[model samples]
Target chain A: MGRWRALANAAFALAVLALGGFGLYQVATRRWHVQPTFHVQVKFSTVSGLEAGHRVRLQGMDAGVVEQVVAPGKPGEPVELVMRLDQRLRHLVRSDAIARILAEGMVGARVVEITPGRPDAPLVAEGGAIESEPPVELSDLMKRTGASLQKLDDLTRTAKTGLEEINAIAGSIREGKGSLGKFVGDEAAYQSLMSLTHRGERTLSAMEDNLAALKRTWPLSRYSDSRSFFEREKVLYQPGSRRDSRLFRDEELFEPGRAILTPVGRTRLDEVGRWCKQASQPQSEVVIAAFTNDDHDVDLAEVLTQEQADSVRKYLIEKHGIDSAGWFRSRKVAAVGFGTQVLRQQDPSLAQLPPRRVEIILFTPQT
Target chain B: MIARGVWQLEQFGRFVGFVALTLAVLPRAVVERFGEVLWQFEQVAVKSLPIVLGAGTSVGLVTWLQTHRLLVANGAESALPSFLAVAVVVEIGPVLAGVLVASRMGAGLAAELGSMRLNEEIEARIVLGADPVPSLVAPRAIACALAVPLLTVLIDASALLGALVGEVTAGKLSPLLFWRDSLVFLRLSDVIPATLKTAVFGLLVGLIGCWTGLNADRSTEAVGRAATLGVVRATLAVFAANVILVPCIQLATEALGLGLL
Candidate 1:
């Protein structure tokens, strides 16, 4: 019985050793599954917290792990990453697939996602390199957005300031403050406007008469030859009338047959005798300035003549006819008061002029 | 002064006597003459098997149930085998064997030594010039040191089997995968450290038993007191050794760069 008991104990010991030994043998030589899996490589400037065996996911589904990392270049250049994917997804991955890192949640792990590439792209191979963008970290995105918002705020402030200035100008017009406001709002503006209507009619009539004179003198009007003759004739036959005086200042402004102005322009009568001597002098390079009661035109015609006034009239009658003078009498100008008010309000310097007469200055250019 | 010197000499003589007598009675001679040690082992190992197996199985089952209950929720059920195998091989097997061996052999050693002191047999040995320690304590120490490690191996195997059964029942894994894949982590580091811890446990249990027994006085109460001290000290020493040994082994393995884990 004791021997049987001893045998049983030995058998139990053998069994225990066998069990442990078998387990140890299996542990030593056990083979794990190694399938051929698809993978892609990405490069980054810095992979801050990334590590091998950290999750690689598609959308949100975990598909692989980071396999290897290499820093081939100097520190600032991109760091390359190699990832190993599961075998099941080999068929789905393509060459042109764009992979990017994405945040999983408000504060969760980072994951890689392959946004499907163009459908026409060729199949991606195992160990093929993939291009990917780094995820925008929370702090970085916030910093960029904050800067953009600041720029937008500056732009908005500038636009608001511009709008406010425009409003102030418009408000001034509504309150009848500036020249435009007075023209549209004040009763004195209407009176000045009526005066401007009369002045405009007179100026039109004068321009017509000048045009008729030119028409009659057209045959003898050589651009160079007549310039001295006209300058001389004007000096010899100066009219005896105040060129700055208004013909009538009556308050019954719109009454028919009223003359708005009757002024005689200055004539150069002494220049007629000097014509032969001054003929080759290039007419002193004649310059004339024309101003309204408002701002001057700055650009106006200049003329030079050296003929006697009666001789120039005879030259006009012989060269052209009476038809031009009749056309001049009927010319009447419209009443806008546009030039009058500009002179009156903006430039206080021009406020002391005759209300209607246009000023013309003639001069030669200095050498 | 001479009396005090003789008294110290007597204690030394007893310790030497235990060693000499234990060596004189060779294991083969003991087997040939009485077969007492073998008989004692059968009684201890076989009688203790049920409780040992029960404790191992229950520990494995509780570990599996609790760990998988939490791990499955986190999708980490596949890691259960690695968890259970490392835990059992490293810490649980040695600790359980040490605790149990201390209770079984330590108390017995203390009791036997205490009874001898009380009966004046120890005093008789001193009168004869044969010391008491060689006669009484040495054989117990040798036997415990050899036996405890073997028992630990058995316990470890039983517990792993229990863990496997629990894993299968829980439906968290397949029995094939458990046998094939899970068993792959049991490397030499795992086994060597475990068995080494068990050997230390055996030496500790034996030392605590011998020390407490020899210190006992010749009183009825002293016998009980010595046995109690033997179990307490052996259990505490086992725990203290574990605390020191685990970190030491971990550091050594890390320095050597020997294991994958």
Candidate 2:
């Protein structure tokens, strides 16, 4: 290298290296060519994966990093985080400055986001503690989610049963059974109906055979399966809590039109009586709802169904020895007569399956 | 085949000897011939900087452009600054800077020494009171080892600047926010070891260049061959060094408690 070229190169090299070295020094010290900083402490019940060296923002502006994490000394004590804030921005962090721990993005690191206090609020002293809002507890959220998922699983099971009933009703309509079957008057339409009926029966049988396979098909099946893996009757009819319902045909519960119990009806009520022994409590409730299409007059339909519901309620209290009333209060045994008013719009479930029926439902309080 | 193996073994043995000799004389040569070392440092570091910055800037700009859309789609545009900072600082900047330096300095040093060897200048120096290894080769070797770390730092800065420019112009993030968020994931353990490893790459460039040129055949064609060999070998060495150094440095940081506050 020549002397003059070396001199020029040295000057250039000195300038570049000096600038780069100064920038590096500033970066290493966390002072990005700006003013100095002061310390502030904030205590959080949970940091939500917030670590030392994570960023602390002031009103979403990048301010500083968490300097030290002093873990709680005893049980139930909050984790204390020491942060270094830019001294120039001290006016923004007041006595009422609220610090919250938030995530940067869906999967990014945790950040202590500090929203500034009112302009009139007094500025906190150096090394002062800022007020904090505790982060959402993951365990509590998971517990609530588990409960919600349990309810959702129950709904999914009921929806499955409803859909199966709809399939059966649709098959019945194809075979000239329900109101929808009135369209099939032509011979060609009848042949098409016959073909569709066989296909529906085959599909229904397949659905019945692959019931467990269907449980594994949906998106939330894994979560649902883990939540309630027991038999449907056992899980759905847990003894002293939630609800258990049984449906009996109107003829099975009462004489053809007289609201009187037959031997077969008595035998059926006995099984329910056994279930009530485990499922009933002093505060437990039983509902007997009866429906009938036997009477043409709406008022007469209402009376007949009402009488049938009353008779079942009476038998449960008298024969099964269930509680009714004492002095101040009574164990509620509500008997509602839906009559011939299937009102498919109001109670679509009533319009389908078993046109004349009575339902017994038991509701028990949670332990 | 046996003869070729013997030749290969002989070459390997001589290479090891040269490496040992350079290591032994390095400290003394650096102190004694400080002026020559400074000149060589300027030649290797300053002169090669423009290309390094250009490469660094383009790499960072392209990385940001590619990543920002995906981040925005996922509502993670906020993570772009810190994400780019960690990637460029710890991995991309050092190795790319090392290779750029190697490409320019490796060929230059080899050709310079090879021409001198062809002209019998090294022989003339040896005939005098001066030793060729210390007076000629050592200064270049020391300069290369020192220059790479400095260049790596420059590359890191320029790449961040390039990414910052993209983010500000297109993504609408303030420069201040970008600068602040960029430091969130960076630490001494990551930056120090990553930049320091480039110095090893520089040492390889200088040594291989000098070794190839000095051991070149005494012909005009050999000078060109030496220059080509210098660049190829140095570039490969830098990449290979990175693969080995990363795990070693990671282990060292954990063992030394560099991760703790």
TM per candidate comes to: 0.45, 0.57
For each candidate, give the interface RMSD after superposing the true interface residues on Cα.
6.7, 3.6
Write candidate 1's Cα lDDT for A230-266 as tens digits.
Answer: 4422421223421221121111221222222112221
* Model 2 residue B206 distance off true place after TM-score fit, in angstroms: 0.5
Docking class of 2: incorrect
Best model number under DockQ = 2
Among these predictions, the greatest TM-score belongs to: 2
Per-candidate TM-score, first chain only? 0.38, 0.40
Span of ten consecutive residues with least summed lDDT in model 1 chain A: A298-307
List the pairs of residues colliding in candidate 2: none
- Tell me what TM-score chain A of model 1 achieves: 0.38
Residues A1-367 of candidate 2: C-alpha lDDT, one tens digit per residue: 7789778876776776786667566566663224588888999988888877787899898788887789999999999998888888888899889999987667756888998888898898889998999876678789999999999999999999999999898888778785567565357877888999999999999988687576545545445544543432232243566666789998887788779999899999989877876665777877777877755576677678878989888898889855543344567777777667553233355456686888887878678
Candidate 2: true contacts recovered, fraction: 0.34
Q: What are the candidates' individual DockQ scores? A: 0.11, 0.17
lDDT of 1 by residue, B56-127 (tens): 887877787888888788877777776687677667877898899888767877877788878988788999
